[model samples]
Target chain A: MQKNYWRSNLKILSILLSIWFIVSFGFGIIWSDSLDQLQIGGFKLGFWFAQQGSIYFFVILIFIYIYLMNRLDKKYKDKSEEKL
Target chain B: MDTQVLTYIFVGLSFALYIGIAIWSRASSTNEFYIAGKGVHPVANGMATAADWMSAASFISMAGLIAFLGKDGSVYLMGWTGGYVLLALLLAPYLRKFGQYTVPDFIGARYYSNAARLVAVICLIFVSFTYVAGQMRGVGIVFSRFLEVDINLGVIIGMCIVFFYAVLGGMKGITYTQVAQYCVLIFAYLVPAIFISILMTGNPIPQLGFGDTLVNSDVYLLDKLDKVTTELGFNAYTENTKSTIDIFCITAALMFGTAGLPHVIVRFFTVPRVSDARKSAGYALIFIAILYSTAPAVSAFARMNFIDSVQEVQYKEAPSWFKNWENIGLIAWKDKNNDELIQYSSGNALEGVKPDFNNGRGLSGERLVNNNSDLSNSNEVYIDRDIMVLANPEIAQLPGWVVALVAAGALAAALSTAAGLLLVISASISHDLLKKTFMTQITEKQELFYARCSAAVAIFIAGLFGIYPPGFVAQVVAFAFGLAAATIFPALLMGIFYKRLNKEGAIAGMLSGLVITSAYIINYKFINVHLNSADNWFLGISPEGFGFIGMIVNFFVAFSICYFFKKPPKSVDQMVDSIRNP
Candidate 1:
């Protein structure tokens, strides 16, 4: 049961971290010029990600992680109590 | 009221607030001194962390840096903030669960070796000192400029204010004071940004104003900026001049380095639960994002306004800010073509990094600098990038009080970070070096006494660095992040996630990372600066980005060594499991 809980935590972390990379490194840096061809309002999509979008996404990602981990902690706590 | 009087009032009130908070929250125990009794609320801790992390560089210089570097400056924006994500996910929660007074304490216990702890302490001291020196210099600059005091006197005054709170209240005092500082600095940063955004683009929100069209016109701010910059022989403001690989590596290095910063990580230990650590990181980023997102906008506005104000304007007709900054030796104008008009183009206007002023005024009453004018370009002006934020309010003709608020805010930013760094240095010395390593019989009261004494000593040394700042101060600030990324981050990350990493592997990894990163930075940045070009950099990665390569090497060396060594003992494995659980 503990192994399952740890596995779940790892899974959540990988998913969130991948999204973080895609926004900041992928859209912002690696493919920034390519994405610059597309504009959102006055900002090129790539520049927005670099200057503004990625920071906002980072905030949201952390909050989501907090919510998910809290739920996971509760789930494991109840299961261990039942076993006891 | 005059700007100086208002500046005095704002600065005086803020100092009074910090000292008052210090006296009220004086730490009685070592726990409170080191980690605020482990009782700070998540949101308040988050605010303190934000203030501690921002520093004077973030508050005053980052926007100016971005203004000059153009799109290439994204490395700092993404690198600094992205590390918080890594910290929240990989390091902070685990470290808080480990529950130690200092980072070295965790290193010692986890590796079961005093040698590992000592190495960690050395790295922490090196990184913290390199960083704190910059903060002290920032305080001196703000005070010398606004309060009209000598720069050395400014450093001394800053030391006393920090010494009062840091030596007495310790972390408990610092945490609350930083919470107040975050409020002051963020407000100071935003007010000017908003005013400039409205003046330039008819948009009050600077973030959106950056993208919006200019007032009474259809041209987007960035589009106009790009056109103007390229026309002046500069790189397009929206385009990257740096190589893509260099940008990628630098950003990665900074991200990992920020996650590894000891002062920032220690803030998580002030919170109550593992969950609060994660939540506090989120809140801290939210607070940080308020300034980070607005910074690019300020950069764009400052660049546009600067160009519009000075380019091709006759020196006799130049604005007061031009001559004011000139008298302070930050900006200079030379009649290069004998035209007497400021032909602000690209390339160096003067022969060196800064202008060496002569004794007399120029033909147009501008400060006469002795540096030979570069004939390569028609540029007649030499403007320091550090002045972009400091001179922004005057350039835009903001109210006197707004200018005063910025001075107070810059001091808050510098002092908060300096106090945080001093606390980390003192704690590592008192707790890790003395109590744990040598004087193991010391009582808690004695440990607390040592902590205060060490903090006072650290502040004095930091003040000296500010007064007699080394020529390499700016270059070495980046080295702090590189060393931290290469050494501390890998050690702590591996200690938590890779349970098989033994003392031999961790120590070997840290030492290798430290040696390689330092050698590369010193070779290129300090010792052989003339050859510090793209052609000579390994893998085309500059010294600023070599830490990423060092980190990779650290991981590889540790894993290989761990394969040969026996696994960590059973009890250590159980301890790792416990931390992983909650």
Candidate 2:
């Protein structure tokens, strides 16, 4: 059961980090020029991602991780309690 | 009250509050000193960490950097905050679970080697001092302007304030003081930004203000800036001037370096549980993002305000802020063409205009003196980048207290980070080097004594580094981040995940990464700086980006050496397993 929990934790981390990578590095810096052709409010899409979007995503990613991990911790605790 | 008097009042009050907190939370025991007795609330720790993490650079220099760099400045934006994601997801909880007082403590026990601990200490000290020197200098700059004091005297005053709280309170003192600093610095930063945003874009929120149309025009803020800067022969405000590869590497280095910085990582240790460590990191970033997101807007607003106020205006008719900054040797204007009007365009230096600094025949102590004695043609105005944030309120004509608040905020940012770094340096000396290795039999009282004494000595040296700074230290400071990314981050990350990794591999990995990254940076940035252009770069990689490559080298060397070594002993494997668990 502990092994399963660790596996699931890694899975969640990988998924979130991939999004993190794609937003800041991939869209923000690498493909920024292509996206700059498109505008959002006053900012180019790619420019906004670089300056603003990536940071928002990072904040959201952390909260989501907190929520998921708290659940995982509770689940693991209940399983061990039952075994005891 | 006048601005200077208001500044004195605000700064004086903040210092009193910090010293009071230091006394209130004074650490009496080793436990309290090192990790705040492991009782800090997660939210409070988060705020303190935010204060500790946002240094003088973030408070005073970053908006100016972004204002000038435009798209290129995104390197700092993404690089600095992105590391928190890595910290939260990868390292913080695991390190908290390990239950150690310092980064070296984790390294020493994880690999079970004194040598590994020693290497970690050296890296921590080197990175911490390089960073602290910059902060000391920042404090000096802010002091010189607000207090009308000499730069060196400003540094000395800043040093005394940091020493008071750091030696008395240790981690407990520094933590609570940092929380107070977080409030001061954030308030000082946001108030001006909100005011400027409303003035420029009719939007109170700086983030939205960046996107909204100008208050009196339909043109967007950024688009307008792009037009003005390009017309001045500067790169368009939002266009990328660097190669994508360079940006990628720089951003990567900063992210990894931010995650790997020892002082920041230590904040997670002050929290109660592994889960709280994760939560604390999230909260820390929220506090950080408040400033980070607001910075770009601040940059855009300041840039537009600057050009509108100065460009093409007669030097004689320039605003009082311009003349006031000029008196401080931060702003300069000469009618190089004898036209009496200031021209500020990139590459507009007059063909025969000579820069005259030693002659003392110009405003602000330096000027482009026209050789013909007729100011026929020369780029007549010089503006220091540091003045953008400092002069923002003045340029916008805000009230005196707001100007004073910015001064207090700059000091708060510098002092909090300096205190945190001083504690880390002291701990490395007393705890990591002395108590752990050489004098294991030392009494607890003696250990605390060593911590306090070492912190004083560290501050003294750090002050010297600030006052008589080496010519190359400012340039070399950037490499500190790369060095941390290369040496520390990989070791800590791999130590947690790879059970087969032995001490031999860890030490070898760290040494190789440090040497190679430092050599690459020195060779290009300092040793042969003339040959440092993109064409001469290795794979077009600037020294700033070398950390990313250095990290890859560390992983390869570590894993390859691990393959040849005997599998870790059962005990070492169990240590890894335990860290991986709760």
Candidate 3:
């Protein structure tokens, strides 16, 4: 159960990070036109996000990850009293 | 407000900010000076790394390179960014876990030999100095243009600013200052790009603007650029004229080389946990992408703006931007009487046009080139693409505040990267060479003092080089990349994965990499300055790409020699395991 919980958490974090990476680096810059076909909020979904939107998301991701990791470290304390 | 006045205000504000941060955050020890005391937050470290990674080349030149080279410029985009992937996956976490202060520290510990560390330090110094030289040149360019000072005075001023922060704040100072710099440089880069995108394609966002069809034109941005440049007697924008094999090798070398850059890798050491190291690389790229993706837009827009501005008039009518930029000496064209002439006659002769006073053209007569060199076509015009970013606001007639922001941005790019490179240079000299190698028992205070001394020395040399550069900024940075590609990268990769590779093999590989790569580069770039076709490079793999060939020689020679020699002893396996395991 604990292994499954940790594994699931890792997967979720990885996906979110991947999205963060793609929005800023990949889609925003590399494949921007493909995403630019769609519009969002007076902005092309791809290019706007690449320039401004993706960076805001990345900043948010880092803070969230840091908070989550702190909780995780506390909740999953080693049975033998190991502490970071 | 005039743009030049705004520029002074912008540059002044940025200087004050960096100096303030440097004063606030000072490093006290070898540990803090080298690696920020291993207490930095991942996000902050990410920002610092972003600032460090995005040099003047990335800030000022990359977009132009892309606009000019098209798909071929993908080598730079991929070669640079791809290194981070290698860093995140293959290098960063392991190096962080290993807990080394510098690259040479790892080399020394892993090999259990001073000789190996010495070799690593030599490579680190040579590579870093070349890189720093480029950054210094970038700083001088930014200063001279914005402040209207002599280039040497500009370099000296830049050296002073870098010294105040790097020497006083050390890594701690640089980290906080770079966060501020990231904000300035990124804003400077993105705002102009946004305007140009809006102007060209009616799309406010550049990344999408690039792909969307040109405003009222059916062609895509890339396709338009391709067509336009081809029409203008230039190579097709997207064709891969380089040999496929050379492309693959050179790109791979750059990837590995970037991954092994000690300055960039050292930034990861600041974050607390191994996991932060991984996340920081991702965030760094995200921050960098803001500029990187936008760069192509800037390049394309500027190129389109430039060609549009200059074509159709004749020798006397080139736009105001031409002469304005020529005043800065970045764009030089020889006129008659063998004098370097700035032309405004042709592009200015358009029926309904008024030029800005900032253009600096004389009122009546158009500036035309004399056929003094006796060439048939006296009307040829050439502009270096580096002027694109600096001249963007002027070309587009954007507000002066926007123009000022750009001056701050360019300096931020050069200074941040120079500080990062200085830390690496200092570490290699003070910690790696003096403290560890010769004077292990030296006081911590003395070591810190020496590190600061080294910073002052490196910055002085780098400033001098920047003022009177041995080569152009981008070209010199390429030499740094080539050195990294040849020496440290192959050694680091082999040391991790190939346990059987012994110290002797690594040293031999490094020496051969340096000797062979340096020889090839010198032969082509400098030694053959006499323009000897006989001394021309092999298979047209220019000096920049020759590092890739040198790497192959290093690897082949190391492996072959190792094949003949004894395997790494049992202790080597234990050392490799230490780096691999938590």
Candidate 4:
């Protein structure tokens, strides 16, 4: 049961961190110029990701992690208690 | 009232408020002194963290840096904020569950080695001092310019105020005061940004206004900026000039460094629960994001306004801000063509980096600079990038009270960060070094007293750095981040995630990381200054980005050494499991 709980937590972390890497490093830096060919309002799409969008995504990602982790904590706690 | 008197009032009132908060939140015990009795609310801790994280560099100088670097500046925008994601997910909650007063406390206990703890303490002190020096110098700059006092006097005054709060209230005092500071600095930052946004783009929100069309123009603000800057022989304001690999490495270094910063990590320890650490990091990012996002918009606005106000204008017809900043030696104009027109094009206007001011007026009443004019370019102005944010309000002709508010805000930003760094330095000494390692017989009260004494001494040293700042203060600040990224971060990350890693592995990793990163930085930045360009950089990665390489070295050494050694004891494995469960 402890191993399962740890495994699930790692799974959540990997997924979120992947998204984090993609937004800032992938879009913002690697493909920024390609994305720059596109525009969002006045901002070049790549520039927006670099300065603004990635930060917003980071904030959202943390809260989502919080929601997921808190629920996971509750679920695991109840399961272990029932076994006890 | 005039700007100066109003500045005095605003600065005086803010100082008084900080002192009042300090007195009210005075820490009596070691627990309070070190981590605010572990009871700070998540939101308040978040606010404090935001203030502590955003230093004079963020509040006063960052927009200027962005204004000049153009799109290359996103490294800071992303690198500084993205680390919180790593912190929240990987480090903060686990560290909180580990339940430590200081970061070295975790290192010592987790690794079960005094040698590991001592190394962590050394890294913490080195990084914090390098960072705190920059903040102190920032205080001196703001005071000299706004309060019209001697820079030394300014540093002394800043020292006393910080000493009062940090010594008496400790982390408990600093946390509440930082919350207030976040309010003051953010308000000061946003007010001018909003005013400029309305003036230039007719949009109230600077973030949206950055993307909006200029007033009475069909051109988008960014498009206009891009066109103007490129026409003046500068890179397009929206384009990147740095190599992609360099940007990638630099951004990664800064991100990992931010997560590893001891002062910021200690903030998560102030919260009551492991979950609060996660939640507080989220709130801190939200608060930080508010300024971080607005900064780019302000950069665009300030750059546009600066060009429009100064370019091609005769020196005598220049805006009052031009002469005002010139009086303080931040902006210099040379009549390169004997036309007396400020032909603000691209490239160096003077032969050297900074202008050497002579004690005489120029042909157009500008301060005479002794540096020979560089004939390589037609640019006739030497404007310091640090002036961009500080001069933005006056450049836009904002109200006097708004200008005064910015002065106070700059002080708050500088002081809050200095206090945070000082507290951690004290904690590492009094908690990690004395009670935990050296003098185990010391009581709680003695530890508290030692904490205050160390804090007082740290403030004095920080003040000295401010008054007689080293010429390499700016470069060394970058080194602090790189060093932290290379040493402290990997040690903590592997300690939790890879339980097999033992003390020998951790120490070997930290030492190797530190040696490589510091050697690269000192070699390029100090010893081999002439060879500090892109061509000399290893793998086209500058010294600023070498921390990423250093971090990789640390991880590799740690893992490889661990394989050849005994596995960490079962008790350590269970400890990691418990932290993971929470």
Number of the top-ranking candidate, with DockQ as the measure: 4
CA lDDT of each prediction against the hidden true structure: 0.93, 0.89, 0.74, 0.94
Q: Which rank order by DockQ, best down to worst?
A: 4, 1, 2, 3
Question: What RMSD value applies to candidate 4?
Answer: 0.8
Per residue, candidate 1 scores C-alpha lDDT tens digits across B498-542 of 999999999999999999999999999989999999999998999
Quote the lDDT for B485 in model 1: 94
TM-score of chain B of each: 0.99, 0.96, 0.91, 0.99
Q: TM-score of model 4 relative to the true fold?
A: 0.99
Clashes per candidate, residues 3 or more apart or on different chains? 0, 5, 9, 0
Which 10-residue span in candidate 1 chain B carries the lowest summed lDDT? B321-330
lDDT of 3 by residue, B92-162 (tens): 76688778788888878776779999999988988888788878877777777777888899888888999
lDDT of 2 at B264: 98
Q: State TM-scores per candidate.
A: 0.99, 0.96, 0.83, 0.99
| Cα lDDT for residue B104, candidate 3 | 87
Error of 2 at B131 (Å): 0.3
Cα miss at B216, model 4 (Å)?
Answer: 0.4
Encode model 2's per-residue lDDT on B1-582: one tens digit a residue: 899999999999999999899889899998889899999999999999999999989999899889988999999999999999999999999999999889999999888899999999999999999899889888888988889999899889888888888998999999999999999999999999999999888999999999999988999989999999988878998899999999999999999999999999999999889989999999999999999999999898888898888888877688988877766666666665656677777653534333333335544333434333323323456667777888899888889999999999999999999999999999999999999999999999999999999999999998997788665766876788998999999999998877789988999999989999999999988789889899998889899988998998999999899778877788877777777778
Regions of model 2 farther than 4 Å from truth: B348-356, B362-378
CAPRI verdict (incorrect, acceptable, medium, high) for model 4: high
Encode model 4's per-residue lDDT on B1-582: one tens digit a residue. 999999999999999999999999999999999999999999999999999999999998899999999999999999999999999999999999999799999899888889999999999999999999989888987998889999999999999999999999999999999999999999999999999999999999999999999999989999999999999999999999999999999999999999999999999999999989999999999999999999999999999999999999999999987888888888999899998888998999999858999999977888888899999999988998888998999999999999999999999999999999999999999999999999999999999999999999999999989989988888997799898999999999999999889998999999999999999999999999999999989999999999999999999999888888888888888888888877
